[model samples]
Target: DASRIAIRHGLPNSAALPIAQHKDYDRMFADIRDKLHAKSGDPVKPEHLE
Candidate 1:
């Protein structure tokens, strides 16, 4: 269930996806932040995944 958050942030099927047992929210968020930041400095929130 918690994994849904990661997937919504574009983490699913991604190499940066954290493991279930050892969740790394910081890394996951950082990856998302970097990706978004790299594309544009504007902070555009990711859409929720169904």
Candidate 2:
């Protein structure tokens, strides 16, 4: 998860961390909307992201 990445690499909360790089948070966050969108069928607002 992005939260875990923030703790693992020690990145600040504001950091988005490159999505095309790592295989964890980077990968998850990259397709968060697409994945969640399939199940929820919404706009996937920022606050709604996990």
Candidate 3:
């Protein structure tokens, strides 16, 4: 998904995105993980997912 964002924004690669953008991507991933965890009723913490 980060790669897709990079490509969509014409970045050379995912690493080329700015730090803020990188964090945004990370947060997006975390949110998705949270949703999945919620559905499965897992007890894992968000920070552990990172």
Candidate 4:
């Protein structure tokens, strides 16, 4: 289920590892969404971390 969700959102399969190990699904999904919208090669801003 975790892997499926990750792949659906265009995240690497490995991204589901921490979710399985630590169960931090909320953070993982939020981080993935942030990264998806971010431009490649651009640095993450402080607000992005929030």
Candidate 5:
């Protein structure tokens, strides 16, 4: 199932997640936020989100 899902998504089989352990969602979100900030020159502060 994992391999099939990966192939359907055009990703390597290794990209599939294991059943035992999951990924760090918070860290992933933070990394995405940082990348977006770097590319957009947008402020990430609470006051700036308004």
Candidate 6:
């Protein structure tokens, strides 16, 4: 999960997904954040992001 976030943020790819880069990492995170927010809890913000 942690690596996914980074890979999806142009930070670094994990040993899980075969992502070579975070082309649309920000957008990916946005979509996920929206979906999660719609369900419950607050949207995932990068302020306190690791």
All candidates: CA RMSD in angstroms?
10.8, 9.4, 9.6, 10.0, 9.6, 10.9
The 0-to-1 C-alpha lDDT of every candidate, in the order given, reads 0.60, 0.62, 0.68, 0.69, 0.61, 0.63
- The alpha-carbon lDDT assigned to residue 15 of candidate 6 equals 50
Judge candidate 5 against the unseen true structure and give its global Cα lDDT, from 0 to 1.
0.61
Q: How many backbone clashes can be found in candidate 2?
A: 0
Worst 10 residues of 5 by lDDT: 13-22
Give lDDT tens digits, candidate 3, residues 1-50.
87778678876773564764777877886787777665344576767657
Q: What lDDT tens digits, residue by residue, belong to model 6 across residues 1-50?
A: 88778778887555545553556875776677775564335656665455
Q: How many backbone clashes does candidate 3 have?
A: 0
The model with the greater TM-score, 3 or 4, is 3
Q: Write the residue-wise lDDT of candidate 5 on 1-50 in tens digits.
A: 87788679987565354522446765675676785564344456665455
Best by lDDT: 4
Off by over 4 Å in 5: 1-23, 38-50
Preferred candidate (TM-score higher): 4 or 6: 6
For residue 29, model 4's alpha carbon misses the true position, in angstroms, by: 0.3
Spell out the clash pairs found in candidate 4.
Answer: none
Off by over 4 Å in 1: 1-23, 38-50
CA lDDT of 3 in candidate 5? 71
> Could you give candidate 1's per-residue lDDT for residues 1-50 as a string of tens digits?
75678788877655554464355865786687785664435556655222
Give the clashing pairs for model 3.
none
Global Cα lDDT for candidate 3: 0.68
Once model 4 is optimally superposed onto the true structure by TM-score, how far is the C-alpha of residue 10 displaced, in angstroms? 28
Clashes of each: 0, 0, 0, 0, 0, 0
For candidate 4, write residues 1-50 as lDDT tens digits: 98789799987787456655565776776677676686445666788667
lDDT of 1 at 36: 60
Q: Is candidate 3 or candidate 6 better by lDDT?
A: 3
* lDDT (C-alpha) at residue 8 in model 1: 82
TM-score of each: 0.31, 0.24, 0.35, 0.28, 0.29, 0.30
> On a 0 to 100 scale, what is the lDDT of residue 25 in model 2?
70
lDDT of 2 by residue, 1-50 (tens): 88779678876554464553567875665587566664445556675654
Query: What value of lDDT does candidate 2 attain over all alpha carbons?
Result: 0.62
